[model samples]
Structures are given as C-alpha cells and as structure tokens.
Target: MPELKLLLKHKARTLDEYRRIGGYAAFQKALAMDRQAVIDEIKKSGLRGRGGAGFPTWIKWNGIPKQKTKRHYVLCNADEGEPGTFKDKELMESTPHQVIEGMMIAGWATQADVGYIYIRAEFMDCARAVKSAIDEAYAEGLLGKNIQGTGWDFDLHVHLGAGSYECGEESAMMSSLMGERGMPRLKAPHAPLPTIAGLWDSPTLINNVETFACAPHIIQNGGDWYAAMGASTKNSRGTKIFSVSGHVNKPGNYEIEFGTKLSDLLELAGGIKGGALKACIPGGSSVPILNAESVAKAVIGYEEIGEVGSMVGSGGCIFFNEHTCIVALMWRTAKFYMRESCGKCTPCREGTDWLFQIHDRIIKGGGRPEDINLLKQICAQIDGRSFCGLGDAAAWPIVAALKVFPHEYEYFIQHGKSIVDTPQSKLMFPYAEPVPV
Candidate 1:
C-alpha cells in the first residue's frame, strides 16, 4: 500500500551505525544455525532474485554441491548497467554493510571459501563505500579466517569492470572476473550451470547486489515473516526497489511491496512532471513498454506485470509524459543496445546494428514504407536466436513499441514528423547539432 522499506530501512553509513540499527544481526543468527537451515529460511521466505530474472533465490543457493569437494565461491553482480536502473548502486552506497552481510550469509550457506563483488568501474563511490565496509568487517572479526569464532572462513574482494554493459550478464561477469573478455559463455544444457562450474571451473553461487542484500533480512526475520509481505501476489514475495526516472517529478528509488499497482509507484515518485502520463517502461529499457491504459491495471509482481504484457525487469520504471514521442524514445533505446552489443554472436552482433540502422533512418525522416514490418521481422529473428539475453533485450523494447504505438511509427514515416506535434516533442532530440551553412 505504501513504500515498504525492508532493505532501505535505514540509511546507515558506517559499520557502527549499521550495528546500532541491527545490521549484521542476521549474519550472527545465521552462524549459530546449520547452513541448510540458513538456506531453508530463504526457501520459506519465497524471495526471488531482485535482478531482471525473478528466479527463486533459494534454488541457486541450494544448487551448490552439498559435498563441497572443490572450492566454492560467491559472486555479487554489482555491475548495474541496465538503463533506468540505479537501485543496486544506491543499495551499495547507502547500506554497504547490509550488502556485505548478505554476501557473507550466502558464503556460509553455500560453503564458499571466498566471495567477490563485481562492481562497475563507474561506481567508484559505491566501490569505496563497500570497500570501507569490508575493511570494517575484517577489523571486527566479522570477516576473514575463523569469522566470529565459528571455525568458518570467508574472504571477500571487490572487483571493478571497465564499464561494459555486456558484463552485467552473470556469465559475462564471471568471464570478466576470470580475466577473460567481457562476453557471455554457453549456458546450461550446453555447458554446466554456473553453480556447478563457474569462476575457474568450481562450484559458484552468483546473485546480484539486491538479491544478496535481501539475504540478511530473510535470515533475520524468519522465512514466514518475509513471505507474508507480498501475499496479495500469486507468487512474488517481499519488497522490490524500483528506480523511477524520466518524467516523474521526484524521480529516485522507491521500495514497494509486490502486488502494489504500477500507478501507485508513479505516485510514490511524485507523479508525472511535464505532462500527463502517456506510457511507461515498467521495467528496465529491455522490457516491453506499457501504454497508460495498461499501466493503470498493472500490478508490481513478476507474474502480474507479465499479465499486462510487460515484466518486472530490474525494477527500472521509467514514465513517459504526453509530450514524449515513442518513436524517438525507442530510437535512442535501440542506439544504446546496438552500441552495447558484445558482438559475440552473429544474431545479436549483426541484428542489433540492423535494428539501430532502421530506427536511425526512421527517426531521421528517411523511413521506407515497409520499415515497420522490417523492424518486426528483425526483432523476431533476434528474439531468441542469439547466444544470450542481450539479443532478447535489444529486441523486446522495439517490438513492444511497435505493438503499443503503431500509429507513432506509421505517422512519423508517413509525414516525416512525430504525430505528437508539440514544441516540447521537437525539443526531445536537442542533441542534433546545427548544420553548418
């Protein structure tokens, strides 16, 4: 109903303040219990991955081999590269210890010998905050050998990537972490699951920053306690932090419980700014765009959002006002994906460029009559044909825009101008440099 600040409960800046606000209490409670019990608590909590894919968190934790024959490693994906998403960055910056404690709990649950936080290079402030928190953790015997005298040991490290969006993918992050190119590897069925063979061919557990940040909470409050929060949704449980941006008046991160209305999130961000809401990308740039009609009925759960023809992807909710031009917005989005494509596979490498070319021409008033169908055809070809999700990510928004705003493309192509014929809409592409006389 309102902002549920489970993870963002306190803006605790230091380890001392964090402890005063009951920060590592969950990790301490976890230490006294069996590792299976720790994971079982997560299982009962019904917490899903806070990353784009809402996979069940406990399954990944439990997937690690119980025998522990080889070294186990835990990985935190701090590379927040999704456009319109900044929740993970805020989590790392504001409550660094919360994230560290969560990872430590994961290390204990999975019998991990070491853990690494793969942060983006641009997040230097977040890196320094987390690094300082880690230093504080070691000084207090909360980390390193014989942690808290439980005879269990875990070493945590921070790694910064060279700011590649492709590395945000789990396998790609692992590749970059191992000093390889920032490209994706063959996933399950073709290769072993990351849990079975990741980061130097050993058992590894990888979860994003927000997913790990939820661990401490789940461990502290019993599983049942966490599960009850989002009972209104079919399966989505607990709270999710959404990074609201674009036309919202007070754009920032707002944590809301599952089953909250999508419109409610907009209101929490202080409503639309320049004009009335026209459309919204309920997730990150990669998810389908929802028209205002759909947004009104959309609920903030994984399945609920899907029912409205979008996904709760990465919790990057971007609202577009009435003055916005859907075609121009999509053109910019296409350009981003095209530039960020890793070029690892033929479908994505070649297909993304094609998509950007089409959008570029259309937005520049050179669109052919068949350009709309061509865009759809290209999206179909690249949706699932590529090596990884990047292809799908590149294709989804284009496909959604075409479906949701068909008239925009049709009118823009037919008249060589946006149908939203407003002075504000003309200003949308202000970056177009003046032609020299």
Candidate 2:
C-alpha cells in the first residue's frame, strides 16, 4: 500500500468531480438499503472515531433512537486543536466530498434533516474549502431537499468555531453550534441524541471529520473488506491518519495500517532530524509520552500504544530527538493545557495552573525532586476528578513523562539544569555563560 490513501489522488474537491469518482454512490446505496443494514455494515467495517476517542462509529450511530423526531442533526467535529495533530485538517481541506458523502449517509441512517461541519477557527483555508464544497453540493442537487431525488431532505452547512480547544469535545461542540460559550456540558441523559433530541432539542448525531470520511468507503466496500486492510485487532482496526511533527525530517500526515510500528513510521518520516530520538508523544499532547526505546516497539494504533502505557490519540506522533529536554517539552505542553482550560471544573482549572507552575520551575533549573513527585500527585488528583475529559487529558502526558524519564528529571533538579541543555558543575545553562547561584 502507498504511504497516503484517502486523500491521495483524490481531486474530487467539488460535487461534479466527486460524483465522477463515485462520490454519492455510497449514499445512494445507503438510501436503497435498510438503515439497520447500513449500521451493521459500519460495525463490520471496524471503523472507529479518528478524533482521539477511537469510539466505534457504528455504535455511536446506533445510539440514536429509531423513533421519529421533529429535527435530527449530523455534526462533523472539525476542531483540530490537539497540539501536534493535523490529520483532520488535511482530510477536510483536500477531500471535502468524503466527509459530505459520509454525513449524507449518516443522516439517511438516523433520519437527520440537517448536517453541520463545525471546523476550527484556525483552519481558515479548510473552512473555505469545505464551505465551497457544501455550496457545490447544494448547487448540484446532491445536498438540500430530496438529495439525488431519493426523498432524503438533508441540508448541509459549515459552522466555524471560535478557536476554543474545548469545543473539540462533542457536547461542547454542540453547545457552541447552539450559540453557547463552547464549554463542555455534563454528559447525562446526553446532549439529547440526534434521533430523539439534539440542536433545538432534537436528536443529534455528531461524529468527527475523519470518522465520517471513512464512512463512504466502508459503505462502498464491504465492511469486512475495509476491516481487512489493517491490524487484526477488533478493538481498533483499519487504516488511520497519523500526523508526525517536531524533530522528524518529514513531518506530515501519513495513513498507515493500524498497528504499524512507531519505528517504521519514523523511518518512513525520514527518521529524526539531526539527532537521536529521545522521546515521543505517541498520540496528541493529551496522551502519555513514551521514551525512545519504548516507542521503538510501539505501533501506530490503540492496542499496541496502550501496551506501552500511551495512546495513539488522534494519531499525532511528535518526535523529540536528543538535545530536546523532556522537562522543557513537558513544561511547554502543560502551559498549553493551562491556557486552554475552560475553567469548567475546579480540578482542571486549578490543577492545570498548578502543574504548569511546577513544570515551569523545573524547566528553569530551580526545582527539587519533590517537585517531580508533586507534579505526579497533582496529575493523579486531576484525572477522573474533573467535569470533562480535558482534565484527564492534560494529566496523562505529565505522569507518562515522569514514569519514562525519571533520571533525566532527577539530574535536572540536582544540577539546576537539563542534562542535555545545561553544562557545568551545577550552575550554567549550555547556551549561556555561567550563572552564580
């Protein structure tokens, strides 16, 4: 198989071009079949959400009740805000019809009348591309009332978010689409599911961009055919989009069969740039960090990544070669969560700030080993104690980094500088003149 799959050679940015490539064929097939069969096909495809959670797509669509609702909605989460993750943006910008086709089919399955593509504020070009695609779909009668004359009155629109990472959360995205502050809502009775109640109290089916993008293909090909493309694991199967960033020579999105080893991906990415690999954030910044050696055996999927105490979250593999200070990297990561904290819960809001402060001290070369222990304690307290996943997400990397690089951290504390970044008996950063303590 080639390095890239879905978006490669996919020049179907518009409805006409997309149709030429069998764009609406899946949706048409979906309309002709029983809704349950379509859902079953998705299940057999083994497609999971590409937006971090990796939740089974078929199960999520099945969560919607079959009963009639006044209004049902399909929302595409295009908020690609995770640090070092951009697979969705590439898919959306390049293969807009894939998403459109997927959403149309999902709407048909759940009887949704409206669909919205909620893109992040930072993806201005992607937003424009998606909006234009929507326009083209509407113009050619592929969208809007009675799509392809199948009596499926689905209307699609693009709604751009205001740059809040919290909006990446499903409920929060729903809130934002309904004109709220973009903070997550308590998941109880849920966001009034798309089959029963969603936007304006209607049943809503919200799926990530990549998750939807995979749908048309799954529907077009038999589910087993799609599932056979990747790892044998039932937990997380099929191809995934991994965004390699940081010290890699080729840092971009690469679609690989699930369970492809991290080492192979690094090699495919042209290896670490200018230095030996030190550590890697296997998933997005929210996931745990793996030391270089651990990542050596790690694979690019949920199961293998979990074996090494990390996740393939959103498939963002950020490499940090030698000379990259783990303490400094963590401090930078902590600061991102701190600034992005929505302050919805006390633990996340207060704990993130505290974690940032401690990491800040350690990175500046003025903290004790107790600070390391304290950071772990704070992360443990924050996990599973906050209102949303953001709190837990912020702490996973902190704890993972400590577990993998304790010695480096201890060296930093005792010498008042990173082992790689500072030189001296104990008082000088390598990049600057000696400092008197």
Candidate 3:
C-alpha cells in the first residue's frame, strides 16, 4: 500500500553501519542451518528473480549439483543495462554489504567456492562501493578461507564489463567473463543451463543485484514474513524497487509492494509533470508501452502487469506526458536496440536495423503507406527467431507502440507528420521538413 523500504532501509555505506542495522545476520543464520534449509526458506518466501524474467529464485539455487564435484560459482548481475533502470545502481552504491551478504548466503546454500559481481564499466562509483564492502568483509573474517570459522570458504571478486547491452544476457555475460567476445551462447535442452555449466564450464548460480538484495531480508526474517507483504497479488510476493523516471516530479527508485496499483506508484513518484499522462512504459524500454487507459487499471505484479499487455520488466517504470509523441519515442528506442544488436544472429542483426530505419524515415516525414504493415511483419520475423532475448526485446516495444497508438503511426505515415502537434515533437525531430499532404 505504501513505500516498503526493506532493501533501502538505510544508506549502509560501511560494513560497521550495515552490521549495526543487522545486515549480515542472514548469512550468519544461513551458516548455522543446513544448506537445504536455507533454500527451503527462500522457496517459502515466494521470491522471484527481480531481473526481467521473474523466474523463481529458489529453483536456480536448488538446480546446482548436490555432489559438488566441480567448482561452483555465484554471479551477481550488477550490469544494469536496461534503459530507464537505475534501481540496481542505487542498491549497489548505498547498500553494498547487503548485496555481498546475499551472495554469501547463496554461495553457502549452493556450496559455491567463488563469487563474482559483473558490474558495468560506467558504474565506477558502484564498483568502488562494492569493492570497499568486499575488503571490509575480508578484514572481518566474513569472507575468504574458513569464513566465520564455519570451515566454509568463499571468495568474491568484482569484474567490470566493457559496456555492452548484449552482455546483460546471462550466457553473453558468461562468455564475456571467460575472456571471449560478449556474445550469447546456445541455451538449454540443446546445451546446458548456466547452473550445470557456466563461467569456465562449472556450476554457476546467477541473480541480479536487486534479487540478491532481497535475500538478506528474506533470510533475516522468516520466508513467510516476506511472502505475506504482497499476498494480494497472485504468486508475486515481497516488495519491488521501481526506477521511476521521465515526466515525473520525483524520478527515482521507489520500492512498493507487488499489488500496488500503477496509478498509486505514479502518485508515489509525485505524479506526472509538464502535462497530463498520455502513456507509460511500465517496465524498462524492452517491455510493451501501456496507453493511459491500460495504465489506469494496471497492477504491479509479474502476472498482473502481463494482464495489461506489459511485464514488470526490471522495474524501470517510465511515464510520459501528453506532449510526448509515441512515434518519436519508439524511434529513439529502436535506434538504441539497433546500435546494441550483437549481430551474432541474423534476425536481431538485420531486423533491429530495419526497424530503426523504418522509424527513422517515418519520423523524418518520408514514410510510406505500407510502412506500418511492414514494421509489423519485421517484428513478427524477429520476435522468436533470434538466438537470444535481445531480438524479442527489440521487437516488443515497437509492436506494443503500434498496437497502443495505431493512430500515431497511421497519421505519421499518411500525413508525414505526428498527429500530436506540440513543441516537444518539434524539439524531438528538429531537422525534419514536413511533406505536403
């Protein structure tokens, strides 16, 4: 109902302050209990991956081999590359120890001997904060050989990525970490899941920064206690931190319970600024765009958000005002995906370029009547045919924008201009010359 501050409860800048606020208590409690018991607690908490997938957290933890013949690894996806998403960056900068402790808990649960936080190269501040926290943990005997005298040895390291959005995908990240090009590898059924073989062909468990940050809270309190907070939503438990930006007075991370209404979350961010709310990209740029009507009734849950034709993807909620042009917005989004396409697969490599080219021409007042259907055809070709999710991510928002704002695309194509005539639209495409209808 309100802003639930479980993970962001404090700016735990130092290990001492973090401990004073009961930070590593969960790792300590996990050490005393059976490893299976730790996983069972996570299962009971009903926690899903705070990453875009929303996969159950415990399933990945349990999937690691029980035999432990091979070296096990715990990976924290600190490369927050999704557009409009800054929650992970905040968590790492403010509560670095919480992230480390969560990874330690996962390491213990899965018997992992080593852990690595794959951070983005641009987030030097976050890398330094987490590095400081790791140094503190080692100094206090909380990490390294014989951690806390429990005879369970775990070492953690920080790795900075070279700023590739494709590397945010799990397999690509694995490839990059192993000194290979940051391209995606073949995934499961055809090959092994990351749990079976990852990061130098060993068992690896990976979760994003926000997902791990929740672990300390889930383990410190009982699982049921965490689950009860978001019981109103079907299968979605606990609070999710949303990075609210664009046309909002307070553009920052606001942690809200799962069942909170979309409008309520908007209100929490001080509502829309500049003009009346026109549409919202409820979850990062990759998810579908929601019209004002859909946004009015949307609920903030994994499945509930899906009901309104969008996913709670990485919790990057961007609200746009009436002055914003949907076509122009989508043109910028397509350009991003096109530049970020890794070119390993034909569909994403070619399709993203085509999508951007179409949007670019349409915005520049050279659109054709058949361009809308052509765009749809390209999206269908790319949606499920690519090697990784980047193709789908590239196609989803374009398809959604076409569906939610058909008139915008139709008008832009038919009249060679945006229907929403505003100063913002002119500012968005300053070089465009209007074609006489």
lDDT of 2 by residue, 216-326 (tens): 888988799888876555367778888899888988888878867789888878889867888888778999988888988776667778887888888888988787777
lDDT of 2: 0.82
Q: What are the per-residue Cα lDDT tens digits for candidate 3 across 220-337? A: 8989999998899999999999999999999999999999999999999999998899999988999999988999999999999999999999999999999889999998898889
lDDT of each: 0.92, 0.82, 0.93
Cα TM-score per model: 0.98, 0.93, 0.98
User: Which candidate order results from sorting by lDDT in descending order?
Assistant: 3, 1, 2
lDDT assessment of candidate 1 = 0.92
Q: In angstroms, give how far residue 148 of model 2 lies from its true place.
A: 2.4
How accurate locally is residue 107 in candidate 2, as Cα lDDT from 0 to 100? Answer: 89
TM-score, model 1 to reference: 0.98
When summed lDDT is taken over every stretch of 10 residues in candidate 3, the lowest stretch is 428-437
- lDDT (C-alpha) at residue 113 in model 2: 84
TM-score of 3: 0.98
